[model samples]
Target chain A: MLVDPRATVADMLRARGISRRGFMKFCATTASLMALAPSMTPKVAEALQKARRTSVIWLPFQECTGCKESLTRAGGPTLENLIFDAISLDYSETLMAAAGHQAEEAMKNAIRENWGNYLLLVDGSLPVDVPEYSVIGGVSNLEMLKEVAAGAKAVVAIGTCSAFGGLPAARPNPTGARPISDVVKDKPLINVPGCPPMPIAITSVLVHYLTFGTLPELDHLNRPKSFFGQTIHDRCYRRPFYERGQFAESFDDEGAKAGWCLFKVGCKGPTTYNGCATYKWNLGASWPVESGHGCLGCSEPNFWDWQGFYNPLSTTQWGGYAQIGAAAAAGAAAGAVAALAARRKQRPVGQDVQEEGK
Target chain B: MPFEALDPRDAGRLEALTATASGAHGPDPEACESVRGRVDSGNVPLLLNEVRYALERLLDDGTTHAIDVRAIPLGPGEEDRLLDALGRGELRAEFDSLGRSEVQECAYPGVWCVTHYNEAGHVAGRFLEVTFTPALLASPPEDVRTGLERLAAELAP
Candidate 1:
């Protein structure tokens, strides 16, 4: 698992004994994950063939290690993990072998060596009120973020904690937690917000950066539009049940057995935007709704403080039933047109099916 | 005293509820079948038209095209209908690399259905490729070079 600093992604894959065909498969999957049309597969393959390993600096602060666990503890060695492994991860408190001053030196050296070129990834929130509340190696979270982000080409807020000041900023905030965006204003920052964002979402962002040398288009929230453009309700398999007004009343109701919508039982999918319904969790095995539970809306800002998770969305002060219905209809229509327009916009100019010289 | 406190009818209902809850991981097969029979998103016709356009492009020029089947939201059983309409051709090729891959030509010339599976045997990607022949079917140049070197060494006397 020794990766050469200068090796291209293709070179790294080949060194790992991956054949060209395997590389093609990887590109194909990457394109799909990035929501790029299948025609872009060759372009992905070509770009990856020349993509040099990027130096990534992962900083963790006031938060649980769930995001790291989600990225690394996916059921098995997925292509996403392989691509992540290809990156030159110079610093990570949990993942790196270096410790204490040695780890600090690695971080500083990585910044000095690849300054203005390296990508910065932050996973927890910053306790701005009392910086000492979340200090690492004697450096306050706020100070460390400001210092590291200055040298980064772009900063990626890896989870809801870093992106939207997740649980730490929920309610009655003790130390006044804040998202990375609040602190870092100069650099381009993209949020991949989730309780622990989808593994593919994280990898897809990395690959998008690698392939095009630019971050993917972002929504108003600065989350990748490709992965978070649509609400979970838009793509839920039980959407038909919701449309038909068939919902499970209780956990073991007949409707529950029949796989009806959990909307009445506090599913926040209608408002929560993430790729959980589409890309799914556990390598497309199942998500919360599929397991007969309501969506906790973990990806949204202040979700932890959202009215009781067991109370139906309609019961909350967010909206009434009629408003929800109207919104759903309007959102669906607009989403369709927007999706089609975006697809057309994304297509590479001039070659339809295959690029020239293919 | 505990047995007397619990009603026999309540115990039976609880057992039934437990069975129902445990099976809630996925949609019931019967309901799925019923839904599949009723739902038609009308994507097949549009996809077929797309395939026709791709074929015309391939015929007019040497350009090839690929449509990701997984990307499109086809309604229940719509994929089957589309695949059935395409109809399988004589040639079928399978490649084992990162996992399993099957490339097969459809009834229409230059129309192909390509499927790639991961090591876990789950379908990772599915594409409808419009080309004279899939590029994957060809031996990569690097592999050919490696083969040549190995063969030459084997033949050396």
Candidate 2:
């Protein structure tokens, strides 16, 4: 008659609203996403039962807050469920109701209490220009970063801005922004870069860290190889069109309606690395490349400066005027069309025949 | 043409001259292998290896005269300086960091190696200077010279 707290995965699934088949499928997806061998699903489920909750501290610097918004928009039941239910979010300015001095104290306490233990997550670039451009509670962003990073066992830079300084550190950068690696040198920092990185990517990195008690091996840019190893171009849905060299000449062209490649229109998918193609976004709804628009390549290092957003496919090298030439050609064509219309309006019905004869 | 006519007495002096300063004891500890042994092994190797490699590479070829590789090690405050240089992509150009652009063949026959140019376009004081030639560009035979240059450059700083 006594209820069992420790139920088999199937019994637990029945208690929660998931069917046995759906629970098995969930296990399979989790296994695949973790880059784990399918044989490890049973082990993972068992581990999940006894695993002590991990602590995570998310720090926001001079950023657009897009990373937080993206995390909130993660799939059903929400990644928040995993963060709160699976892991303890000790302090986050955006998520926590605690504010001002108390919030700051909470972050400090967490670091001191969990020294060489807890994970530190950061979003946004560290502003180096004048310091006044970005300040939190009278302390420079750089100062705060060094303090937190010094004792952290591991650090995760959650967005492009935090990873490679994103747009804030682009050429002729006014804010003098720098990546987390620039300021935080001692800790092992993993960079998850993108304007707003795919939700599954965020979750996978966390799960990997929690499961292994250490971060996965990172690439040259400190990005997890499992997600960022392949180019966006490699997995793009419209890659067939790119291979055939069938590109949409204009945004509103018939080829565009047919979902032709956006490479000719300056898609940086070929150079950029991310899991957008594999994971998709908005609960696997669709990514930018599938929406008939060229990829902006927000994930790659110094992408804002290195790859022009509207650079045509033929232009391979960085820093050129391919965009300017395209704009000029369009301007000239528009002018010619306007002139023809005026000439037609002035010409009489028979004048057309006379002009043809002439 | 007058090989037999040359003085045998000069050969002894030439050997002595070639051996000059090589084994001589000096106050500078770097030249003294015994003194170099006592210094912090970590710092010594880092500095000595980097500089020695750069110097050897720069002077390997006959074209360059004086070789100077500006060795800047980033410690604490130097991070900002290094980061600024890296961000601008000017650190390599200004300090003449070894790169793909520095590789080239010379007009000399059979000989082949990497080269660099000074501010005045002269090869003097340039890093990784080596003798390279056009005939060496051909395959099989070319691989031998190219392989040597690559090996030497890798051994360089």
Candidate 3:
């Protein structure tokens, strides 16, 4: 169903049989996802109540359609999907019913109608060297991205491919693949990088823009800090094991069975920054770590070339071994000092016994 | 090895771990105590202060507020501590729409805790609403109006 451009999000929701309570619930979830304090729910609700349906154009190039699946088929009709459905999604080759010339026309009309206001969401890397490597409606990926980005309010790189030149840009890159940032330099750009980023991360970014009228604060890598601020290791439930120097040696080992840290088994949680540990996947069901697999570090740049997935992080060149070394040394030093202090405390109690033995 | 290849006991352990990590179930008390020191309790005081401030705002301007408990970086057991400190009041309510929702008043008047669960029975969102009555409990004005029209139509014949 096409959402009316003039209709606010609240209007669309109401028409869909959602009550004010449901809307409030949605705002609450959005606020939580964005890491906004609970007190900000009212503000979020107020902003959404007046938020007009934004025009969104989704362009998929050399992607596997996993990102789209992540966003659309996140379990069921989630609140995120509700917001996505309410938006005026004018052009999506995979989702839109119109095809061939009719599909191209719909995109042209959307761009013309919402010039300099529409949000451009691009997934997958672009083949700059060989434009023919990927094309849609007779337009090469590179040419299409540059053309659409010119009129966009902001360009959101939706997956690892579009954000950081994913698997296609791996070593011996064949397509001369480059991320959206390499091509769309002039537009305000944000990256939601992941091998199919978390659905909440994608929608939360959109909600922040709709509620605050600006993109959420981004890290140096141009990723939303709210979702990518902390590494997966920092929040992983198995962190206690990592701290205690316990690790799963193999996929079927006793450590793995006991839910120990996957660091030794080539887990990339320590260096990979994403919300997977905290938010989980499949609607907070379980993440890679929880499911007995190491993080593939898909969200970070050049993850595919980071040695091997099953190799321990310390063995990988991109693992930030220097930081790990310093942290390990500090932990050892602290442990030594604590042990010394405990010995001193015991010395007082055993002083007479020691003297008698002498 | 794939997840299906794991021993059933191992699979159960992973499932339990996932449930515990996702806050679907509380951590075992013995395990909780062992890791208690590792977790930070600072958010509890800050949250209590926010609750106090919200309560004052409710009294002063008659404006209700809600604090999303899930948004805060709460340490283990901190949530339970905060709830215990608030103490349960007399009123309690449960409703179902998209999923189950529970709203219960706190010891302090105008302070309520609201928890929403998804259809899968997983906690989707949690909040502390500082209002005389949560908006969820009341019939929406539109719904009330529609009900009135339906009743009138039935009487007209």
Candidate 4:
């Protein structure tokens, strides 16, 4: 195949000092991760070699910029090499060199020139309730999102914000936050959710698209099945602790120091899903759970509103415990009956005992 | 004779194994440390331990009738394959006859799964795990789930 002179996975990898062997290994890893056959690696490798440069416009909305922070700290190569080196990231309001009118002009030009081919990566929610809550260049985020998304080839909703309205859209959503799916129905949308999804997850999606020229298969939630398919509980390292009923009751407790399960300490790991454990944060050094913190389940929809951060799963099923209380009451009744029988036996034949009781 | 006389050292090993099983004594510190080291090294045995530990916690026993496999980054047509296996009674029978479930809880979020099996050694529970990274999807499709299932089987105490 006549590999593209530019934008090939090899060229990108080489620029990062990754050897040809390492590049193939990466492709093989990607292919395997996608659940593709071993034979598919060559195809993926070829596709990536021939793939065209994909222009991406990353927009930060009303957010703490945590998503960007996580992306910057993503595992693998330097942050610049991962994003700027691979994809033609035309404009990132956070990182772009241009500023003021020049920045805005560059964005406008990218959208106009790229037209239906560019990818619009949105990292926050759109506040419809209050236009004044989040504004960029005198226009609401919703307005700019709709404008750019209209001509986009595809939309990547980065983080829980853009994916599921995130924390902003939690109960009593003050800004009436809405997900990207709600507004942009014209194109395919890939929801890469998390408080800020694993940075490698974000970059891998770009790699998959570059290699396959299409987004990876997604689950019902529009999340890439490869990443958001399973629950955090399923792959938790503390699972053994959970199994043995060894749990950390409180932060900094004995069990916590022993690395016991946090299920009793309001760990949402069971129901939540993400690759925090296997692929630790900050270049695979360590994640929150490894550091003795419980999972907050920031990826799931309305997590902040529904799943109580301080509430443990064992205590959450309040009704189940009610049954236990009932059982205890029955046991008490049985105990009372047994005591009465014992007293009657101790008394002179049944007659005198009843009379004395009366 | 079918039975061979045991050497004194062999007898000692048997006694040690028995004591460990009785919970009067646990695996020696060196042995425990070796296992921990293996796990940290990402050895295949780590996967087995994780799967088994999860099963023991969830099912109270590693007995089941059927097992269903869900690969990381579930493939596009993989569901159909599973459904077919389930419908034809192959999967259901495995659960009906002998199955067990296993779960893997990684530190990362969204990398969990469950499996099922039966009392007669069939897998009845689901195999669940989270995958926050794309690296998990880097396994060969056919082998991934099967390998997981095998590891889960080994995880049975």
Q: Which candidate leads in DockQ?
A: 1
Q: Find the candidate with the highest lDDT and give its number.
A: 1
lDDT of 4 by residue, A292-322 (tens): 5678878776667653676764433322334
Pairs of residues at least 3 apart in sequence or in different chains that clash in candidate 2: B58-B128, B106-B132, B112-B132
Please give, for residues A155-260, the per-residue lDDT of candidate 1 as tens digits.
9999999998888886666878888989889999999989999888888899899888999999877889999887777676677665555666766556765677
lDDT of 3: 0.76
Estimated TM-score for each candidate: 0.79, 0.57, 0.76, 0.60
lDDT accuracy of residue B90 in candidate 2: 15
Top-down TM-score ranking: 1, 3, 4, 2
Clashing residue pairs in candidate 1, if any?
none
lDDT of candidate 4 over B69-92, digit per residue (tens): 322212122333333322321111
Among all windows of 10 consecutive residues in model 4 chain A, the one with the lowest summed lDDT is A344-353
Q: Give model 2's docking category.
A: incorrect
Where does model 2 exceed 4 Å of error? A1-26, A35-39, A313-358, B1-157
Per-residue alpha-carbon lDDT of candidate 3 for residues A29-67, written as tens digits (9 for 90 to 100): 778878787778779988988888788999999999999
Q: Let me know the TM-score candidate 4 reaches against the reference structure.
A: 0.60
Question: Evaluated on chain B only, what is the TM-score of candidate 3?
Answer: 0.74
DockQ of each: 0.20, 0.01, 0.18, 0.02
Chain A only: give the TM-score of model 2. Answer: 0.79
